[model samples]
Target: MPLITLQNVDYGVGGPLLLDDAQLSIEAGERIALIGRNGAGKSTLLKLIAGELQPDDGEVRREGGVRVARLEQEVPQQAHGQVFDVVAGGLGELGAWLAEHHRLSHAQPLDEAALAAVHARIDQANGWDAQRWVEETLTRLELDGEAAFAGLSGGMKRRVLLARALVSRPDVLLLDEPTNHLDVPSIEWLEGFLKRWAAPGGATALVFVTHDRRFLRALATRIVEIDRGALSSWPGDWDNYLRRREERLHAEAQENARFDRLLAQEEVWIRQGIKARRTRDEGRVRRLKAMRAERAARREQVGNVRMAFADAEQSGRKVIEARAVGFAYPGQPQVVRDFSTVVMRGDRVGLIGANGSGKTTLLRLLLGELAPTSGEVRRGTQLQIAYFDQLRATLREDWNALENVAEGRDFVEVGGRQKHAIGYLQDFLFTPERARAPITRLSGGERNRLLLAKLFAQPSNLLVMDEPTNDLDVETLELLEDLLADYPGTLLLVSHDRDFLDRVVTSTLVMEGEGRVGEYVGGYSDWLRQAAPAAYGASSAARESAPREPAPKPAASPRRKLSYKDARELERLPARIEALEAEVAALTEQMSDPDFYQRGGDAVQAHGAQLARAQAELEAAYARWMELESQGS
Candidate 1:
């Protein structure tokens, strides 16, 4: 059954239409992902569905008795209230019922039987172990153990809001940017919870809006793309939607090319006919009119932002290096300790950690904006740096886009060279009219893109960007990714956008608490694997020792399933084989040197031959890995 329906919804504030005659429907068991650029009315559309805002000229219908719950990114705080009180506020009628039961039980004249019945009702009103469930949810979001609701950070506050929404157990769940400001584990937990909540026979139907690519890939059953104030449904996840969108764009481009060629031919014919003054000149004019109409029909203009980073000159070998780095705030204890990393030329490094884990502070220390209390910060010669902070306060509110880029100052070089402001803003996808708008009037996404444009245009070889993808539109993100992928300079980016990190950075610099930096091979997934043992898996004492190395030759074969222990053993097989091969090689050299017979008895000779045979067998066994990899790939 359709849970909520919007019919010809037109939402606007005063002057411009935000969403124009948009229609959308939600049904039971459907997981819909709402994606669009920031300020493109995604939040407004959610508000419309929640009935928090009235459409200008449309009707919204909800199924009778359908309870919907919405989670806002900015959770409201109440004065003179405890943490449990606000979290329990979403219980509504159930809370009222429980309170009534408590009142009756506390009465002095209450009968024993009635008291017992009221106690049972109270327990039933709350879910099974409801108090424990609430506590667990709060703890998972890192809101417990000295982190109270009023004392929480922005990211922790978002988690508390999510807990409040989930505790209600509503029929429809409306989550706006749930993955925003959440750590990887929290995101994974939320994904699992959402999936379980939207399972068959569950009350909730999830409508999740997020920019996290992994969350979208894991939770979305269908994608609803909101472009230009309109919504279109796609069959699968974000990856599939991207593929289909690319194909559609390619087809449109081809059609435009074909139409352009035909129009060019028609233009030549019209020109030739006018020169010759042919008998069919009137028909030729009609044909030209028809050609103009066809061309008008084929010409389509889509509004999109284009941004690219400016090139940087080569820097020295040691771009940045820190030794015995230690940092702490004024009142708090040390956060980063003895952290050391070498960022040379052509290194794209990612910085990953949970919220309040000093990732940003570490970047600041590397940039030399904040000095470490007891360590040395070293940098190579002629190293230029550009920083992209999430707050995007670099832009001046009073100034226009062009003037903001110019920074309200002009300097002429010795040769009288000058730079124009409008040309620079235009490079960052701003037109003359847009460049004229005050910076305060620009949207969050527009401001973020503008900041990026300015950062890239500057003469910088080493870039230190912190949460660069926070408010950027998807188009700007892709463009930035492309530019960074091709960039020859060193990048030390701290971002939560997994797709962007994977596509742009080469290595990740993890800032775990206690001022330790652990280097892991590969990308984000690799770092996750290395960190998983500590964060999710068992203790190191339970792990097996390193195994022997493997031989090199293999062709192809079939794979066989292995149990947990068997898999572990299989991992060691190659290393064991390599060790045996090395031993065999050493024995062969010793035998040729005529020292083997003199140093040992017949047992040594027999042992050497047996070792050679065992090594060959192990090599053969290790060769099966190629087939397994092929199959897995």
Candidate 2:
């Protein structure tokens, strides 16, 4: 039997059905990737499985006593407390008691009676195990229990939420846009952790909704998509799902075309008054009526998002150049240090770093929006730059989608051609009615589309985008990737999406922290092959062993010839790299144990140093592997 089953589920919100007679079964040890367009009931389905929402007209059955936990998409604005208490809060009422007990015990003036009462309730509920589980979860995720939740970075906060869900010891875990605000490093850590959490015989099932292609490709064993109030399961990897989904869509189209043709014929026959009223044709008329009803009730597939970039004017061969650029706030460590890069015309460069590592600041510095604290930035002439802000600051909240795209005008120029604002918005999949809806009425994906519409309405020679992939569906992301890949302009992009970076950018600038940015010759995956262990969340070690590739000079370079011995070494590098990764993993696992920190600060520091050294060695090995692969005799 499946762990959970939804039988003939019918759910809607007074509009067209979001879920109509949907059936699903979730089994143990399966990592299911739930995908659908925005406002397509993906989150609602998650809520149904989490038992947070009931199906309006169907049975949602869970295996008896099966525990399920969910991590919400957005970090709660009001969630404030020590990390431990917040994690414990997931335990429901017993957790509440324990949190209260901890709070009372830590009060400046000890409230003896209150503390005693709360402690009594904890004991009565046998909550000591729950308390221990919370501590263990925090240790496993390396979260500081006493640390203020609000003080943590976005990635750290996500880990805390994961900890909260894990503390419940749930048999099923549901994550909504788990990578929404995470940095690349944090995302890597999450992938590793969740893989372990749902390993075979781990007694847990994983289901998550995400637009992060890399994340989906890494984890999902099955793909479940919700479309037109129906659920379809594709059992395989992402590539397989893509192929099958295409075939299914094509088959549906053919069937619809056949139905339409027959309906047209029947309409013509029915209009033949004498033949239609004849007794022999009476049954044919009834069939025709049924067919008409069927066609009327048919749900048409949503249209694909149509996007076109305005043609860009040519810029100087040297788009932007920096001479030993650096930026820092007073008294704070450098956010970017000695960062110099030369981006020529049509060079697509990606910026990568942790959440606060200053990718955006680096973009600003390169674009000459902000003067570097220490060096100079030079801009090429005739650079008409179009910036896509990650914060969506370019949009007005009070305005509708149409108004956002067109501040006051009815028509906007694109690629030297004028387009009515509503027509352009329709190209982005926004309907006429939806275009008039307020900005708040738009979903995250819709808002992102609006931002894209704004960015593409003007001509530019340089396109600077920061985290533009967030909240985008996979189809739309792929389309944007194709556009960027073909764009004939200097492109400076800052994104944590590994796949997006790999597919679009020609080069990468990695922020190795402490303001040191290293330029590499390829995208995120290329950088990873040259710096994998570090990409897996070992920033300290990565920094220590980071390659010394500076901003590339535009000159023809010859490749090194690979000898027979070099070829042999290249063949052996994979095993060597794997062994080094194993060592790093072992060290990471040892350090994750709660007792590792319990021993002593000195012991913890020593182990940490050991881990860092191992990671540095791993980084060097990966760099060497890539280097060897690049060499030719």
Candidate 3:
């Protein structure tokens, strides 16, 4: 039976309909991904499924005794006290009982009945080990349990919320953009955890809304899209869903065109009046009226996202050059060390690392925002840089969308010509009505679109964007990808979206913690392939030079003689080689699993190290075996 079902749901807030007759059924162990354009009601549907919101019409049904946990896009405002307490509070009844039990245990005269009642409540809720589970979840999320919730950073607080949801282990998990504040490592870990939680025979069901293509590809077993006030479902991963959705849309467009032609003919017939006495066909008129109403009720299809970047002025051949650059904050350890690289004109470089791995610091160093403790940075004389900050800090809350984009200018320069601010806003799909709306009234994706529109209006030779993909809808993301592909400028990007990196960046700079940065020749997948242990082997020249030597001539004696140590070593070599080979094979198999790389951080590093050690040991064993065999050849 499906865990949750939505039947003919009609939901809205007295405005235009957001969801019209939408239907959905979520079953056990189904990892569903919800996708659509911004303001298309994806989050609203999730809220309905989570029981946080009621539909205006129709019924939302759930199986008996089912539980749901939701990770909202916005963190709760009232979460206080210790982090442990905040997370444990998600347990509901058991958490309250535990708190009461703790208080009663310390009373001046302890009440046995009160303690017994609390224990019974805990047992009934199956939360006897809730504390242990909370601790484990906190550790997995890399959060300190003893820390105060109020003292944590925004990102840290989001992680804590995630921990709480995970510890609850609800029957259905509904996540809305859970990857927004997560670093690459944390995202990978989340992927692995979700994969494991929803594996075959698992009871958990996952339904999440995300813009991360790779994450969707890794975890989604079914794809659900809300478009034009309707719901569509596909049983596949992201790639399959993409192909199917395209085909479906094409078919829909064709059908709509045919319907429009027939409707036009009907309208012409209705316009021509017939003599009522001779040819009175009231039924036909009524049918035509019904058709016209149906056509009018159909939602107007929105046009594709149109983005055009102004051509940037040509700069010198060398855009930026860094020589042995290093940086350290006051009274802190060095965060960037000896990072030397040359960024030539027209180069698209992607910077990637963990949360505190100095990606931003390195970017600042290159932009000359901060002076390096050592070495030098040289910028071309003609270089002009345009930056897109992730935080969207440049946007003014007090201004409307039009004012924000215009930045107090009536006419802005684009493509060497003056363009009206309202006209420019129209290019980004903002209507005049919406343009006048306050920035605070816009959704996250809309705000991101405003930022992008502002950024692309400027003409610069070098463009540096930090996490530009964050909070962007899928359609806008694709448009941005197309825009960047056609951009004729040097691009430097820091983003955690693997698919975006693969699509836009030609090369990558990986910041492996502790100030070590390595340059690679391709995208994220290319880097992963090149960095794998299997890719590490002797070069072609080394392989040719290390061919086995011809076997030595047999000794005169009937049996080959050897020292005691040599005989013992020969005896042990076969088993040792076998063991090492088995170990290498096991590690290789583990790495082949998609979840292996998604595990990230120490888990991946440990496996890589183990595989390397096993390979080395195997090589040594083979060498000894070759020597032993050559002695009696």
Instruction: Give, for candidate 2, the lowest lDDT window spanning 10 residues.
Output: 592-601
Q: For model 1, how does the per-residue alpha-carbon lDDT over 1-633 read when each residue is reduced to its tens digit?
A: 467878888887754466777776676666789888766788888888888888889888898998888997545645113445455556665544443454455568977787677567757766436545555655655455223467766665666677677666577888887766666545666666677778533345788777777678877756777765666666434776898778877997898888789879878776775546554468767877897897764424335554445555689988889888899888887978887878889899888777777888888888888999978889888888887877777777777877766666542111123445565566566777888888878866678778876786576788878777765667767877897887778888887676777788888887655667666655666565445435332223212221222436697565556657656756776787678677766654443332332333234335444654766676676666554444441
Cα-based lDDT for every prediction:
0.68, 0.84, 0.79
lDDT of each residue in 504-581, candidate 2, tens digit only:
999998888767888888887678656644533544433443454465678846887788888888888899889989
Off by over 4 Å in 1: 10-21, 73-81, 89-147, 254-304, 310-313, 328-333, 409-420, 426-433, 530-633
Q: Which ten contiguous residues of candidate 3 have the minimum total lDDT?
A: 533-542
Q: After superposition, which runs of candidate 2 have C-alpha atoms over 4 Å from their true positions? A: 107-109, 273-280, 531-633
- Residue 167's C-alpha lDDT in candidate 1? 67
Residue 359 lDDT (model 3) = 87
TM-score of each: 0.70, 0.84, 0.79
Ranking by lDDT: 2, 3, 1
Best by lDDT: 2
Sorted by TM-score, highest first, which candidate order results? 2, 3, 1
Select the stronger candidate by lDDT from 1 and 3.
3
Q: Any residue pairs clashing in model 1, and if so which?
A: 337-515, 548-575, 548-576, 549-574, 549-575, 549-578, 550-574
Best by TM-score: 2
